[model samples]
Target chain A: MDKNYNIDEIENFLNQEMSAEDLSSFKERLAQEDGLQEEVDFHATIVEGIKQSAELDFRALVQDTRKAMLQEENTAAKVVDLNQNSKSRVRSLGSSRIVAIAASLALLLVAAWWVFLSPMSPERAFASNFTTPKDVLSAEVASRLEETGFANNQAALQQLQEAMLTYQNDNFEQAQQQLDAFQAQYPNNEFAAQAAYYEALSAINTSDYETAQVKLLDLVDTPNFALQSDAKWYLALNSLHIGNIELAKTLLDSLQSDSKHGTAAQGLLRRLR
Target chain B: METSTIVEQLRTGNQQAIRSLYQISFPECASFIKKNNGTNNDAEDCFQEALVVLYRKVSDSNFQLTSNIKTFLYGITRNLWLNELRKRSKSGLKLVMDEQSDREYILTADDQVEQKQEEEVKHKLIAQAIQRMQGNCKDVLINFYFKKMSLREIAAKMGFTEQYAKKRRYKCMESLKQKVRTEYATLGL
Candidate 1:
């Protein structure tokens, strides 16, 4: 083995860029060389390792996406609980009042066909279903630190925690600023997706639908974003909020089979119809 | 989406396709794993591994799907969990597979032994080495090799001359090779 063998020559050979004569000579050398073949194999393994690293990154994305979906499902479950409580409250009403109320409800049902049964306006549907997603960032970060015993990016996590606190406090404007700063400072951090997600939510809460749409669209297009499906669902609502009914329909149609949002999407579709 | 479309989209690294798969397939997979002795975390791990296997297989131009994507993924996940159980010396426990016909899609040569144990070890070492590398070096090497970016494009993207980019890539590769060698020696490989 030549100690002075050029790495470029090896790269060219591996990449199949070598001329036939050079290739033949290189092949013959490769056949006879002791350490050269091992070096080539090592380089090849490094390339494979790099590719595997990218795949692992994608796997992380998939894991985060799953976690986000689970969080959304929990939020939906809370909404369902609220509905159940309302139903139970109705059940607890006195019998005499219930009977009187039932008589009025029967009369109201006839009027409801003429009033509520008409196709709901897109803005109304958006308002009805678009609750702000519950703030789970703090819990998630705490659990992650507990599990790992060390935060890989402690400073970023701290900043995100502060921003999430602002979000939780209903200070949408400041939270959006802090999240934007977090994103700017740590564009490739693991929690950047979460930051982006919260920023979009803030925009929605502030009635900045255009900004919300832009941010949510970026999330929708981002291949590894954890809140991608949530972004899609919210983007649909944002579209409806802005009276882009067709876009809302299209987005909702895509999410019509999403486990967390599917039932809501179907109900909205019915109203839109 | 159709199974074929999912396969194609996965090959392209489309997240929508991945989301679709999770939406349509993962609940059943999770239930099956939990029905057995596995936890939800175990099910997630097996499902991710199965998706990786599927991605690798479909990347090969000669590969063909003989079953639906869901069934194929279920088969792979079941096999993975079974192997894991065997590793834990719990193979005596029977896995509650919902469908017997799913056995037809069990991964054979491709999944069980995708790489020799030695090769897998080497790859892991290399991955560790890459992770420990400096940001610029790692980026240059990955962009050139894994990303298939031309030197000119990389140079433009990184704000350097093409010649410098090529030299930087070579230096990065050398650095990575040295790191891998050190790690390999540390492992007493």
Candidate 2:
């Protein structure tokens, strides 16, 4: 076995960037190099996580785009297109934009604009797409993201994005480590809330509902949060997932009566029933 | 319902045909902007660009399809939509909060030079495998498949008797078949 089967080599293999000759050689060496394959699988998980996230992101983007096109036409015809956008049963705003909206919303709550959006704005209708497009989460990551200010810091943001891909690929330990690192590095950074939120989501994806709930519960009141509403939404959804109808109803109640979420939330609420 | 057919109908001011084509391909092509990591609004904007591509392709006689009409339209749409997505992803990420998923599909076959490059990759892969043969075997195969040369003419050109040419031709075809199978298998096709 070629003992030189290093981390870089394994990462390259995971990426499918290896030359054909290198692939042939790597295959030849695989029979006896047990550790190498293990390392390769670890990296592969991270790579696949990124891809899965990308796919969800793309699908979400497409759904939102379809709605957006329709909305654009509506925007051309109507004074308050929000009402019409609310009518959409499915749609998603881009993640960063959603986070900004959430943050701005928090800012508005404390400061000047309490409600920047028109009740009829299509944004309300499309909000469900954001969570659907988001990866399954552990409550820990979910709650971490609930702290609105977490999504703003660049370092925290990079670590969280990297962790998201890692978690999706089932590199739980690495993901946890990354999350821990992110929390340690920028606990109050803008991306921190989202990062923490995803940390919880990563746990949820693994079916650790109790842990996920704990993580979410931890972040429920964390101030300066970007995804508090989303965390609440996920908590409510998680209750349904765990077969706790009463708890689910309670969590759902905490969210603005779907009408506040606009038509999309109302539609999702209808579906939940 | 196709841009090509619609273009034909459009030339005669057939409003229904034009609308049918636009209605079918426009939103899909437009929506791809989001599917490949763009905002919903960006996808809407992508429709006009996709229409422009259809307009150009429909006018070009060489743009005949060997595939389904929608697939062709989608191919073009996916290409054009992705191009805009890339441009926006780089510049608009700041204003945009969360990035959309699926960024690995940079440029697909519908995008101008990228389309040509993909075809060239296909040609090169198959052609290189064919190059594995030598001398008469290679020459006979190329003459038959690539040049579309007649057996009698090839025999004369290669200074071979017709009988000898025929025998060589039989062997050459077997070799070609094997090569094609290996090449295609490598591609998992």
Candidate 3:
């Protein structure tokens, strides 16, 4: 950071108080500048932390109430069960009959579990939870594309579309080639993250899980990668493919609270557990 | 009763409202989890998490439920169970029919995992600091930030002048940031 770098400048950036020209310049600096960007990210973390704290408080309240209710209900149920058991014994429902009934109920529960509920392996869980994002051109991305620059940008967009289509069509090699070409042509393009993601996915499709994992890890480490979470998820899937259970669990656990992937991640985590 | 009333009651920490939620929602949710290889404990835990999610959403003044509360709750519970089912596939559990429609609820497929985790840790640290703070500081900070109240409104609510409220809010936030930074320094996060 420059000696004159004021921490309060981040507040201006965050609060949208910077002039338009300054804002654009700051963003350019943010993209290219290292330490300054880290500072901004650190400050943003505190703001986000404040919000999370409030939400956590609310969640804690709900959980506490639920816990208390469950505890009380359990105690009451235990008393009722005890009374019913003594009453049954007094009514001459012999110990043998009681034991037989208990054994039958246990068998019924086991049979029900085998018939209905069954555990899943982590690999199977991954397969079930992992789905291709239906279209990479999400509504947010589509609207932004309209406002983007032309010429090389337009060509890059076209190449990206082709790569995505080829991947969707299961042409892994062709998709990888198109993505490689796209990245080579526009190494620092705005959509570089998306291209890298598809490249990784293409690698996965071709059963080159190691290459896919590497590509996804690169994206995961890159600052301001637009698809960082998607990269993390694909990386987790890669871990599962390569039998790195601990790494996969770590990635999926981080994603469990994500708005988009929370359910999917939780599903995967449950299996791992 | 109207769903809005139930939501309001929940926000106020009404125990009866919580019971109502459980009574209406838990059975089907438990059944779904059980069929997907989850035990009663798993079902209860999943349902509670779903309720927490719902509570967060409903408590947000900006949120509007497009579906009936029951439908939305069921949707959340079902999504949670399906995810659990996926993880437990080692038990040879198969996807049931209802999962096909769960796709509609996915808002986006992108994430900010590392950054989110960073924030999550800081949140725990910050929450601890807030808990240690005097009640007045906590109230002022919560009102100004979480409740999105203006300084004047906060002042009026707490029976103080706007200037005092503003100063106190700043002081409280600064104290919180200092605590967080100290912990970060110590823990090297």
In model 1, the runs with Cα more than 4 Å from the true position are A1-28, A94-273, B12-14, B31-39, B58-66, B90-122, B128-175, B178-189
Indicate which candidate wins on TM-score. Answer: 1
Candidate by candidate, in order, the iRMS in Å equals: 5.0, 20.4, 12.2
Candidate with the larger TM-score of 1 and 2: 1
Q: How well is candidate 1 docked (DockQ)?
A: 0.28
Model 2 TM-score?
0.25
User: Which candidate do you rate higher for DockQ, 2 or 3?
Assistant: 3
- When summed lDDT is taken over every stretch of 10 residues in candidate 3 chain B, the lowest stretch is B94-103
Error of 3 at B174 (Å): 1.6
**DockQ of each model vs. true complex:** 0.28, 0.02, 0.16
> For candidate 1, lDDT tens digit of each residue in A1-273?
225557778878887999999999999999998788887877677888877765665676566545544543444454356556866897787457768899899768745654565688887888888899889788887666567646567777888889999999999999999999999999998788888889999988987665576677667767777677798899788867755566577667667678988888866876887
What CAPRI class is candidate 3?
Answer: incorrect
Decide which is better by lDDT, 1 or 2.
1
Expressed as tens digits, the lDDT of each residue in B1-189 for candidate 1 is 799998888766665567678878888888888998999899888888877766666654456777889988878787777767765774334343334454543322223343567788787677667778886887787666655778997899899999999889878877787777778778797
Best by DockQ: 1
Q: What's model 1's TM-score?
A: 0.53
lDDT score for residue A73 of model 1 = 46
In candidate 1, residue B112 scores what lDDT?
A: 38
What's each prediction's TM-score? 0.53, 0.25, 0.48
